[model samples]
Target chain A: MTLEIVSPGLSTTIQDLGRPGYFHLGIPEGGAMDRLSLRAANLLVGNPEDAACLEAVFMGPEIRFGADMVVAVAGATMPMTLDGAAVDGWTSFEVKKGQTLKFGFLTEGARLYIAVAGGIDTPPDLGSRATYPIGALGGIEGRAVAAGDVLPVGQGTGKAGRTVAPELRRMPGRPAELRVLPGLYWHRITEAAQESFFADEWTVAAEADRMGYRFKGGRPLEFVEREQPFGAGADPSNIVDGCYSYGSIQVPGGTEPIVLHRDAVSGGGYFTLGAVISADMDLIGQLQPNTPVRFVRVDMEEALAARRDQVAMLDKIRGALA
Target chain B: MAEIQAPVPGTFYHRPAPDQDPYKAAGDAVAAGETIGLVEVMKTFIEVKAEAAGTFKGYVADNESPVTAGAVLAEIDA
Candidate 1:
């Protein structure tokens, strides 16, 4: 079976759980921004939780199915339709041959996940179907979907009408709260700045995408006076190039703070005050431009607990869908 | 009256750039699919187009203001 793209959305790409263990080689763990949503969509379509799905941002592609297939959409709040008939999201539905799927304007959230029963059958690079466009690795030709691109689908036995309950969904707040663990170059900034970072409400900037999310409208960070270290630039926010973990919050020029995402560079020169906890990383993917956010401080123990809670939430989803 | 709604959430712009004149002003004739404004979302600027030919009634939303999807950006007299 295959899916033919009639029109590519704003930024549609195939993504799975992502390929890990390549960060040391300067390659990030590029994958779906909303990992939970991807997994949910996959399970609804009876595919492996990590099976490749289409991740569309802001808008969704117009796709024509070449054969009958079970499909599900998760993440974001974009209304979808099948052959001009309105379809409910977070639920699986069957599409017949020649049937087309399209989407309406996104009313909430930034990304949406569309999962097929057999998954997108693209050849995986480094054991992943996730697209890393910056590195030109993975997905179909390592890029976003284009018109007339026919994507292969693996064999599957998924059924239709499987719905993910409302309470089971992870809904982001109006002004989302991201729990951060201060580390790395935290000492480089003054105490006043550190306090202000958590105290001030920051607005998501227009530059948010798969690579990173930039937040503006926060108070400018003031750096502590210190002799410039070798290899580090004169900017107070500059540091000797260091590894950037997923969710690393880097503030360049101490003006706007950017949270590195799945496709972000492995290392950079900007100073990272801390990282948004892993549990909250997926929430960042759903935030829209101008969305206000606050950085809530958390300790290592709290971070670990939050991670366990995330795992539990996944377990609940699996059990409900099983 | 025909309404021009924002397709995505972002900062809406009346001009192509900060220094340029707006794409349309009050009482300007607008053609269907004509670019009336821009909505900058995820660093991508999408042209807000008029859905039907009409007389421009001016922008309802302020320039560079943050807007939500479905928020009326401008109106036109059909």
Candidate 2:
């Protein structure tokens, strides 16, 4: 079956769980900003958790199904309509042959997922179908979906009408408390700056996209006074180019702090203060501009616990749906 | 009466920018797709447009107030 894109929303691209082993080769594991929702959507349609789905940003897309199919939408509280009538998201629903699906303005969250029961049949790059637009890797030729694009859909095995619990869905609001695991070059920053990093309410800047989120409204951080080592740039914020962990928060010129996300550069010269916990990285993506964020320091144990909780939550969703 | 609802949720601004005048006020005329305001989310200002042509009514949402998706933004008398 084919899904015809009528109006491609902002940055609508295909994504999945991403490739894990290729990071050492400088390939970013560019995938869904919200894995919980992506996996949930996939499970709703009886697709594998890593099944490729559409990642719609800011707005959603208008697609006309060429054949009957089941689909689910999760993440972001946008108005979903089938043939111009409203339909609830986060549930598996059926679409008749030649019927169109459209989305209203995004009310909450930054990215939303649209998962067809059979998964999106896109050419995989680096062992993944997730789109890394910067490097031109994976998903619809490594770019966002454009109008007039005809996407091939796989035959679905799941039945329609599978709905997730209301409480299970993520609701967007202010002041997300993201957990951070302080490490890497955390000691390079003065203690005062580290304190401020956790203490102040930082606003996500407009420059934020899939690559990273730049935080404003905080005290500009300062590096400890020291002579620059050879091969390290002259700027105090610069270090010898080192590998970056996913969700690494770095400061450039000691100005606004930026948290790298999926599709982020693998390594850079900027000194990273710490990495945000993997479980909370999706929350960073959901935050609206001007949304308040406070970084909470967590131990590795706490971080792992949080990840376990998320996994268990997903399992719970599968149980509920089953 | 035609009520215009917010398509997306964020902080609603009556003007395009802080220093600019609002697109419409009470008693102003508006056409469909006319930009009436902007919703600031993650620093992206998405234009809130007039859904249909009508005589503009004052906004139900306060200026610079946080709003959710599907919240009624303003009304219009066609």
Candidate 3:
């Protein structure tokens, strides 16, 4: 089966779980920014959680299915209509051949995930079908989906289709707190600065994008020295250059914190103050400009617990679909 | 000889404040770790420090313009 992209929205691309174990080479593990929602959509249609799906940002594309298939949409409650009738998210529905699917402006969050049964049949790069626009790798030509792009659908393995119960759909609202882990450079900032980062409410800056989300609030962070002290690698004296990883909170010149995301670069000179715990990165994606955000610190133990909880929830959903 | 660059992606500002004079003009002597420019990402303003003491040469990117990581902001004669 093939799906035709009529309107590809602001930024839409094929994404899977992500590409790991390549961070040392300055390559980011690009994947769905909101793994929770992606997995929900996939599971709703009886597909594996890691199956490649369309990651739509801001809005979604208009598409026409070439063959009958079970599909699910999740995350960022955008106004979506299938054949001019409203369709609920987190539930699987069969689309007839030639039926049109269209989406409208974002209602709550920044991105949405649309999963089709059997997954999208795209060539995988580095063992993943995720699209990393920067450095151009993976997905459909390593870029965002554009008008006229025809996405091939993989053949299903004959698994019985399943749908999500209404009670299982994600609640419509914004999260108030963002869980975080102190990063490598966390010690560089003063105690007061750390306190402010967690206590004061900050707003998402307009400068946000897939690369990173800049936050505006609290007092500027101050450092003991202007120059970064060397720990290892390039001479603490040599300047380092490259893109940064997703969810990394960077502090440059002792100032406001900027959280990097999926499309972010591999490395850079700015000190990464902290990282939004992996499980909480999706919470960052849903934040809109001017939305209040508070960073709540969590220890490694807590982070692992949160991850386990997330994994267990997804596995349970998948089992229900089986 | 050495060159100075913006350490991160942001909008380059020539002076520290809106009403202040430019930090250093072309051919001005500069010291290592001196603040030559500022890159404003979000509402945070970060001073870009020169890595090595040198004579200020010229800017590769214009002031008040957006730049990506590693984009050379200015050249210095070390």
Candidate 4:
């Protein structure tokens, strides 16, 4: 079976859980921004949680299914329609052969997932079907799907009518609060600047995408008056090129703060103030441009506890779906 | 009556560029799918298109002002 692209939506790409253990080679673990939604879409269609699915931003693709299949969409709040008839999201539904899927203007959030029963059968690059467009790896031709492109699908059976509970579905908060753990470079800036970072409300900028999110409207961070270290640039925000963990919050030139996401570069010259906890990283993806946000500081213990809660929540979802 | 809504949220631009003329002006004939303006979201500019052939009424949103999804940017007499 195959899926034919009618009109590829704005920035639609195939993504799975992503390929880990490759960031050391400068390849980010590129995958779905809202992973929970991806997983929910997959499970609702009887596919594995890591199955490859379409991740569309702002809009959704117009697709004509080549064969009968089951599908589900999750994440964001765009209304889905099949063959001009309305269909519910976060619930699995059947699509007859030759039926087309489309979406209306997004009502909320920034990205959404469309999971087919057997998952996309594209050849895996680096053992992953996830697309890393920057590195030209994985997905169909390592790029976003274009008009007239046919995507092969693996064989599998899925039962329709499965739905993820509303309470179980993850959504970003109003003025989302991202918990951060201050890093080793925290001392580079004045304590007052650090306090301002958490106190001042920052808004997501127009520069947000899969790689990272840029936040503005916060107090400009002031670096301590110290001589630049060897190999570091005169800009106080510049460091001696250190490794960047996923979710690292790098404020270049102490200006707008940027939170690196799944597709982040492994290392950079900018000093990182800290990272958004893994538990809260998914929320970053759903944040819309100009959305107000606040940085909440957390200790290692709190971060771990948050992560554990996230895992437990996933377990609850699996149980509910099963 | 026809409305051209912003497909996504961002800063609405009435002109193609800061110094250029607006994509459409009041009373101008707008063809279906004709570019009306642009919405700059995530550092990318997406053209807002008129959905029906008509005479352009005027922009509803101000130039370079923030707009939300589905907010009407321009109106047209279909």
- DockQ winner among the candidates? 4
lDDT of each: 0.93, 0.85, 0.76, 0.91
**Where does candidate 1 chain A have its weakest 10-residue lDDT segment?**
A166-175
Per residue, candidate 2 scores C-alpha lDDT tens digits across A1-322 of 8899998875689999988887788888889988889988999999988999999877788999989999899998788889988888888888898999988877678788999988999888878999987788887888889999999898889788898998777654578888999987888999999899999988777677888888888888878998898899999999998999899999898789899988788898999989999888878768766678888999999999999987788888989877
Compose the digit string of candidate 3's lDDT tens values, residues A157-248: 42324566654444324435778889776776778878877887776765877678888766787554436445422322123453456687
Clashing pairs in 3: A242-A267, A243-A265, A243-A266, A243-A267, A244-A265, A247-A260
lDDT for each residue of candidate 4 in A56-147, tens digit (9 for 90 to 100): 88888899999999999999999889999999998999999999999998888888899999999999999899999889998888899999
Q: In candidate 4, which residue ranges exceed 4 Å CA deviation?
A: none
Interface RMSD of each: 1.3, 3.5, 10.6, 1.0
Pairs that collide in candidate 4 are A206-B42
Model 1 spans > 4 angstroms off: none
RMSD of each: 1.2, 3.2, 13.8, 0.9
Off by over 4 Å in 3: A157-161, A165-175, A226-246, B1-78
Q: Whose TM-score is greatest here?
A: 4
What is the lDDT for A322 in model 2?
Answer: 73
Q: Give candidate 1's fnat, 2 decimals.
A: 0.79
Better of 1 and 4 by lDDT: 1
Candidate 4: Cα lDDT at A10? 74
Q: Is the docking of candidate 2 incorrect, acceptable, medium or high quality?
A: acceptable
Which order, best to worst by TM-score?
4, 1, 2, 3
Sorted into a CAPRI-style docking class, model 1 comes out as medium
Instruction: For model 2, state the Cα shift of residue A292 in Å.
Output: 1.3
lDDT of candidate model 3 versus the reference: 0.76
